[model samples]
Target: MAQLGNIENLIAARELLTSSLEKSKHLASAIDKTGRKLEEINQRLPSLEAAIKTLASKCSLSEIGRHIDPTVGPAAAVLNVFDAVHMLEESLSADPCSNLFRYLSIVKQLEEALKFLTDNCGLVIRWLEDAVRFLEGNAVVDDDRYLLNLNKCLRILEELRVTEEHSLLSGGCLCAAYGKLESEFRRILMENSFPLPMASSSVSVGEQACIASLPFPVPVIQKLQAIIEKLTTSNRLEKCISMYVEVRSLNARATLQALDLDYREISLSEFDSVQSVEGYIDQWCKHLEFAVKHVFELEYKLCENVFEKVGSDVWMGCFAKVTVQSGLHDFIKFGNTITKGKKDAIKLLKLLDIFAALNKLRLDFNRLFGGKACVEIQTRTRDLIKKVVNGASEIFWELSVQVELQRQSAPPSDGSVPRLLSFVTDYCNLLLHDNYRPILAQVLEIHRSWDHAKFEEELLSHEVHDIIKAIELNLETWAKTYEDTTLSYLFLMNNHWYLYKNLKGTKLGDLMGDSWLQGHEQYMEYYATLYLRESWGKLPAMLSEEGLILFPGGRAIDHDLVKKRLEVFMDAFDGMYKKQCSWAVSDKSLRGKACQLVVQIIVPAYQKFLQTYMPWVQQEASPSRNTKYSAERLKNMVCSLFQPKLGMYGSNTCTNMMGNINNAAINQLSSTPAAA
Candidate 1:
């Protein structure tokens, strides 16, 4: 079994060796065939290389000669470009101001040439940029010299572009041309622009006839538009825009100045009084309306027409510059000055007028200054409106403060209406007029909304009520200044009557309502009664029957006692007449009623007392010696009590009259038979 296994292993090893030898022979044969093919390929290599070289040369030559003019070679084309650049430089050398149309034509040619170069010479531009980058120390791999050499046209272009002489001819000359265009733009604008007509006194003239149309003539606008197109094409739009702003701004300012709307030159101190500024305020309103509605409106139209092809931002910037430089700031500044000036009740009315004027023009302001470029104007205008609203509101509330201050002043000694009272009532009357009522109502409503977080339509009425209440309190305080209770009551009656009489049938009366009117009426009546009671109510008591006695069942009268009472009554009547006669009631009807009240209280009582006792006293003496005042005389004296006895109430004549009356009363009393 071992011998047979050995024989099988030898047979397996021989079969494996035979299979390996067959595979090696096939491999050697394949290797020999591959080497033969390699030798054959090597024999054709040089000829194929020579053929490829010929094809590459032909392709390069074809690419270089493709667009070459048969008559004008690449060299001539380059020279032609240089000639075109030289011609552009020479054309730019001519002043644009001399002939702006001709100059603009030349600039248009330059723009077209630049655009053509940019479109056709992109690769040359990149190469030149790369070369410039390498020169500037940036890493860059240079392209092949043959490729670079093939594009001689583009290479020359790059060379011409980098040269200082070409730069001066192209960039520098074009800049000078743009500079000339800017000057021409300014000159054309200045020549064509004219001041707008002076504003009419009437504000209802919404805009001037010229404002409805373009301010510039058609030819001038076209010329300006042409110049703008050239400048825009050259990417010099900012220069043109700045020039337009400068020229047109001056024109707008001139127009406003012609309308007398140059508020910056004005001084508030030029006016003699706050009231004197009313005319200026009126003028301000009219001129401001004209400026916004006419001058600026025209300017906006001009900007739109001239820069219509330009972007809105550019035109808006130009318009904004013109509007601001043309005294719009000064107009608002003037208003601010007025609001920030002296605070007074009268100034409140002025501020309301200013507010109304500005408020009226709010839509115009928004329309004109709505752009981002006019943001400062919009903000300042809104701020001024706020200032006017707050200032007018503050001054409106100062009515109460003024009343409180008036309380410190002396009351009218003649029991007439206090000046402060009349001032307040008159001021309120003005405020409640048709022109100011709605405006003030709106202002106060907004003010309340800001301060109290609430709004009410009756806000103005409430404010008026508060002011009236303050005036009433002040009247009360003033009344106390009079030492005589009668004059004090008379003072209250006079002021209340004055207020009611002046305010009746007016808007203010309607606001105060019937209840308020009735209340004031009752107040006047109550004070009138007090005056009568205090002045004459006690006179009747002096004649009362308590002190008198009838002896033996009224058959005999006590003559001594009655005579002594009569003497005392005469003395009291004489003293009261002298002292009370000087006090005055300024209102006619009020004075009449007041005098009648005194007569009603004392005259009937004294007359009846005389009817009973005068004859008893007369039995001892004549009537003249027995009684200084008869019923008729007492009635006459009472009727004359409230009349102004001298010139004016507080005048020297009034003082002399009081002194003379007192002296006469003293002399008459001392010489009387009762005193003797």
Candidate 2:
């Protein structure tokens, strides 16, 4: 009986164990299915979350919070349901079945929430559109309508902040509620409606500065030539080239902005009611044009001096306002908001560079070989340069008309507005290279052995050659695509400058010496001391080493390197003075007291400049102390002969008149202002 019972128990126990193993397999399958479903839900969350953000962005908080439903607002209702469902699910999720049940419920809830935001809350977008439309059409200058309306929309978000049952939802509610407010704030800021006031309040500081608003307007154009000396490394070349292009672009943009505005109206009184500087942007541009241009020019000139290119855009936005000059009649002021983003604006800027180069080319050519060659070349080159200029100038009118006509007309393509700028730039490059190539070749030929090496290095370097080839290959794509004809323009003028320096720095002054020195006493007054003026009245530095040797001047006393033939000259004029003929009148003060030789020549030579510019000297004393004391003592001794304020280097060309004042002012400020 016991054996029978054991066998029966073993069989029953085995069957029970098998049944338990089957149940376990079925449960594992169910769990795997649940995990797959959860995985799908997880994947759906990102898409649904993105949709929520999109909808939220479309609507204002008021639209989301202001529920038309009589029971509760959608935001409030969604919050309540999500919290209640979530809390109950969390509290009951103790076993596997409970966890699965809660997870399924949460997934359903999330789907519903995403649906509400996407489908039902499109009204939010409509509401936002209405708000934007209302503001755009009815925006008034100096009025707070935009701000007040924005704030009203923001206040409605308070509904989203209050939690019906869960305090935890309160923070999230507030974040969701004010999200539109934050978006609107950002939008307003971007539009410059309520400008975030800067902490320093130094916007007006640079408004009075002046700079050339030309893309390639180099205040110190001389410095840029040094970089081409010996570029051995490709990286350095790339860096410098990029810097050069960027600086060139910036200068051109600044200059173009300064030139673009019609300064017919606007004045100092405009700033009073202007809460957003953008409202009175014209005025700001006018005021800051000075400083902006100065900053632009200064940076560029510094880069030029450093023989590097500068393309720093770090402070571009911050100093955007700096480029607008408020108090200018001649130039257009674009307060510092620069626009290099647009391809058209950039094209226009390049045209300006070409224009500036042409002008400089013309001037330098005229100055270098003034009498015959300049006149002859001017006749040839002037027409070509003029055509390019005219073509480029037409772009502004063409682009404006294109934009205006686009609303009614077909969107222009190859032969339309897009390529109109291209036509202009192309023509400019053609004119520059075609007729100007000879000039550039001549310029290259004129340079010494040292210069040939430099030109070869810059133009024929392996990297630059590759760059040039690449640029040529893609030339058709650029609106400004043409051969680098500006090199002709630059090279011609560069040669002219070399010749000009040679001509002006040599015995060319000797020709005029006999006829030019009659009015010498006028300029000689500044040079009674060693202020470095020539006998005919000119700054000693203005003369070349060759010319300085011909006429010894004051202020600079560095001895020339002894020539190899000094012994021959020494033997020739060993006793030429004949000291017995002229008795020495020993007067201690005469060396400094008598009129300086440079003053005599320069004063008379620049009678034209002096006549117009002499009266504007601000400081009565000499910039150098020794000059000042000597001037004062001389003024006392020969008060009748010496004019108090007038002197050489007192006046400058209109093209760059203010730089002189600024340089001296900066010097004084650095040296004396602090002490004072």
Candidate 3:
């Protein structure tokens, strides 16, 4: 049984081996067939890739065609690309301006076609370029059918650009569109732009707030921005910008005109006097401030809003052109006119006002005209500042010249402060006001810095010192006019006292320092002392006891000599009282002090002389005739000195009384026996 099972197993094994051999044979045949197919495919791969690239290029054309006509099949569209371009050129050649949107659509289509040609037709373009180079005698290239077709397409595009009628479809159409847009931009700006509410003298906060807001409505700005974007895209933005500058510049000028600042028509001849020029200067300051603060500021904001999409350079340039054309040049020119006009002392203050206005607005100038396009405006503004500074300096120094020219030969007989001194003090006071001190100081500093030694110190003190010195010299010159030594002293005293009192605690005083006050006080005191010594110093010596008593006779006084001395003393006192009573002491305290000094010096000497001599005179027949004034009466007379002389009504009474006293003294002296 084992043997028989072994035989069967061997037969099974044989059948299995047969089945495996057949399967292996089939696998070998399939592998051989697949390897042959792969070899065939590998040999055709290059041509297949070329066909795919050609298909892609055609698909690109189909994509463009789909954008134009959706019903066309891809193959038909690719075949009709040149025909479609030619049809678009013909459609665009008609009045493209009739329908701007339609015109823009055609332009966009051309642009798309141009992009497709540039991207996919590089080889064809290179061939054409070489052909052109060949035509230009640079090289030669063999032509083919493919090159010819592409050349036809390129020629259609070139016709759209070059043909007189169709050129409008390309750059000319867009230019016309932008030109219309520019007109629309102008209309929009003009209609929307209204003059800001202007204050005649100053800009109120409300008006400033209004000016700070956008000049145009949001819709208008958006419209302008849209037009600007179109122009920018078409590379024709300069026309739009120029139109904007022109319109806004006229608007700015109109705004100034509304403020009554017709600067261009203003002539130097109109300002015939300092007063007339002063009125204009005030207007100039107000108008300039308004122009800078409101008009130019509005223009700057308008530029920023309209050209926001454009660069800062574009906005800044536009703003600068508007500012220049908006009468800023004429405004500064008017200021220059004033500076170049006749130099007057009062012009100094007006020029200083202009300087201050410009100085205050300097930052605004730099902000508005900061670009290179507005360099001339900036330069003119700076030059105006320099002119103002120099003009102010010239006028200031002329104070001294005016003083030197004041060659008055007679001082005021009232012995009060001189008119020149008063004017000078008042002028200096104005110059040293808080509003004008720093300005004048800066003017003086700049002037001194240019011509004088190199020093960086405060110049107001030196300037004030020079002016004071000139005034002092002038006072000395006038003081010499007084033939009365006493009156001259009194004149000096009054003026020096006035200077000290006027400038004691003011800005001028601060500049003059404490030494100035002390020096003037000393001058007043010195003048007072000299006035006393010259007027009444000899009265006491006239009645001196040394002359009354003979040297060899001990205690033996001459009665006749004593009486003669008394008569001479009375005559001298009467003359001095009559003369000095007319002179004025304007200040109450100064008058009292002067009266007291005269009393202290003259009264005691007169009283003591009377006390010593009246005894000898009483022995005469009638002492009453000799003693005309008692000590009490003499003190009263001394107290009455230095009071302003009576007016016309009181003068008659004083003159009659003085005449009666003189007649009584003369009768009594004549009636008395001759001294022996």
lDDT of 1 by residue, 5-28 (tens): 333443344343322324434433
| Cα-based lDDT at residue 240, candidate 2 | 40
With candidate 3 superimposed using the best TM-score fit, by how many Å does residue 612's alpha carbon deviate from the native?
22
Off by over 4 Å in 3: 1-176, 199-211, 215-219, 263-265, 272-276, 394-402, 405-410, 444-453, 484-487, 522-676
TM-score to true structure, per model: 0.64, 0.18, 0.59
lDDT of 3 by residue, 1-676 (tens): 1222333443344343322324334433443453344345446545644543454445443332223221112212222332333344444554533554455556555444433333323323333443333223411244233334334544533433233233345465434444566666777777886666544446633234443545688877877887787768767789888988888898777777776766545666766434455666777887788788888988998899889898988998899888888888888988888877666555677889899888888898888887887888888988988888887887676666666566454567868665456556666767877788887777777777778745343556566667777888878888888888889999999878877877888777777889988899999999988988998877877777766877676777888888887788889989988988778775667888888887778778878887877777888998977688987888788877666544411221212422322222112111111111
Model 1 segments more than 4 A misplaced: 1-72, 84-102, 114-159, 162-172, 199-213, 259-280, 394-408, 518-585, 588-676
lDDT (Cα atoms) of all candidates against the true structure: 0.66, 0.30, 0.65
Candidate 2 residue-wise lDDT, 360-412, digit = tens: 44443343323341243345445444433443333332433333332232211
Weakest ten-residue segment in model 2 by summed lDDT: 667-676
> Clash number for every model?
0, 44, 0
For candidate 1, give the lDDT of residue 644: 62
Q: What is the lDDT of residue 471 in candidate 2?
A: 25
Better of 1 and 3 by lDDT: 1
Considering every candidate listed, which one attains the maximal lDDT? 1
